[model samples]
Target: MPVARLSPATLSAVRVTLPGLGVIAVAVALSLAVNRLVPAVSPLTGAVVLGVLVGNLPVLPESARPGLKWATRRFLRAGVVLLGVQLSVAQVLQLGGGMLLVVLVTVLTTFFGTVLLGRLLGLPRGLTLMVSTGFSICGASAVAAVEGIVEREESEVATAVGLVTLFGSVSMLVLPLLADGVELGMWAGASVHEVAQVVAAASPAGAAAVAAAVVVKLSRVVLLAPLAAGLSIAERRRRPAAEGGRPPLIPLFVLGFLAMVVVRSTELFPEAWVPMTKDVTGLLLAGALFGLGSGVRVRSLAKTGPKALVLGLGSTLLVTLVAYTGVRLLG
Candidate 1:
């Protein structure tokens, strides 16, 4: 048999750079366009939608897969770094004594509530906890940490994350409007997930709301250690003989993120450099979101679309209503 090989043109066509770059471009464009058209939806959410669509559909050639994967990984890593730039340790301290208590209570309540709701709806225990934790704490990090101890299948984690992303996006739009109408700054703070999403959503509510929401979100993040530790213990008890080989320690990036805040508060980095740091962080996060969207399979999302949508929407409504009521009474 004669040996055959790919031609130069064919090899070039197989490269992922073009398609990956194209997807990023499209995502940014779509996000901007959607923001203009809807005004209510955040550009980040729109970008996520665009990324998912481009990644899932057969919009690119197989030859580009390598490039796409590389791009996605780079983006994700950058996003994590960008996320660090936004932190300020002084802000956490400024939240005051009672504010921290409120955040702690809400996080615990939401975490347990989501899990209980999932179980009542006949969701698997592992999936229930994964979704609950992701919603109650930080998004991707919560999922990653829980996955280490839970031993659930990858599909379950994906399903939970997909639910969080879908619902978290919805919250980004809905909560801001609710906050505006109800003047529930504290509620908005206690309810929203990611700090960036909260700020983007609450920007319309004025700077005070944005500041409050960020404080609340960061306070929730501080619970990650105790939450992870408790979960690890529970997981070990449940598995007994499974030998999970020492529950993975809390990730270092989270500690780094907190440390960056401390550095910022202490003026370790000059004030003039802060803007540059934030800009870099934003770019990194945008790249990460792009990568995350690209990795999603449209078919899988479609298959679970109804369930994810319903769960996410329902959870948002529940959280908003409760938080709004609580904040109004307490604030």
Candidate 2:
């Protein structure tokens, strides 16, 4: 029998990685608990908050660092891949060409405008991109997708996610109070960062408005693949030497996302299984955000200056105005 040789480095790596996985599990559990108690705040948001708390507190040990980092990258990508199951090509098309155009314009403008403004403000590109995607697309989920491509620090991701939650929560309160239900619905669909925020904002407008808002929001979500592809291309252009030549047209995870969308369109899961799938996907994403959050240091984020806050506020206003214009013209 041939003797087997094992490398000490590989053994050490496994030891560290396992502990990190455990840390992620704990964060996921905490997120679930928070979401259960506070339905208004999603598990994804709760996870990030809890991760920050755990990181700052004495609860998280140094040994868990490797696992936390793993969760931040690998888990986030996995969650995003699963996100596609929640969307469908057919659903996006059903929104009608006019409304689809409105969504497209809103997403594209918000994305590019945010990037331009971030440059003007002298903010870091990674942080700016994260905030833009979070605000422009689907909040935390979009942040995760962009994070995978740009590979920013955990604190930057936290900052972007925090901004999204702050404004999205505000929309829930402010949009409903508007005088015109139709306008409120359009604004919510067009401007709000998260699907939950959109629904909360538009629900008061009644079922019809709620239905329209969801369809419009889904149309925006469908653009995530294209956005990721564009960003990947841009990233390659900015750092061709480091990144090594041209990037793939679509990332593997994004391809997985598109595949899931196709699978969903087939309606193979049956209606009863859809909710279960969503629940599972939510859990995975929440855990991933939690992992990202744990890497954040509150002090470091504050040190980055108020430009992030300004960028976030600026992006929010841009999307809101653009969305409102499109909705008025098309909705």
Give lDDT per model, in order: 0.63, 0.82
Candidate 2 lDDT over 31-66, as tens digits, reads 778767876687889888888888888888889887
Candidate with maximal TM-score: 2
Considering summed lDDT, which 10 consecutive residues are worst modelled in model 1? 76-85
Q: What residue runs in model 1 are displaced by over 4 Å at the alpha carbon?
A: 1-39, 124-130, 138-183, 194-197, 200-205, 221-247, 329-331
On the 0 to 100 scale, the lDDT of residue 203 in model 2 is 86
- Superposition error at 70 for model 2 (Å): 2.8
Scored against the true structure, residue 77 in model 1 reaches a CA lDDT of 42
User: What's every prediction's RMSD, in angstroms?
Assistant: 6.9, 3.3
Rate residue 124 of model 1 by lDDT: 66
Q: Model 1 over residues 102-166: C-alpha lDDT tens digits?
A: 67666777788777677667766777777777777776546544655665644465566666666
TM-scores of all candidate predictions against the true structure: 0.71, 0.90
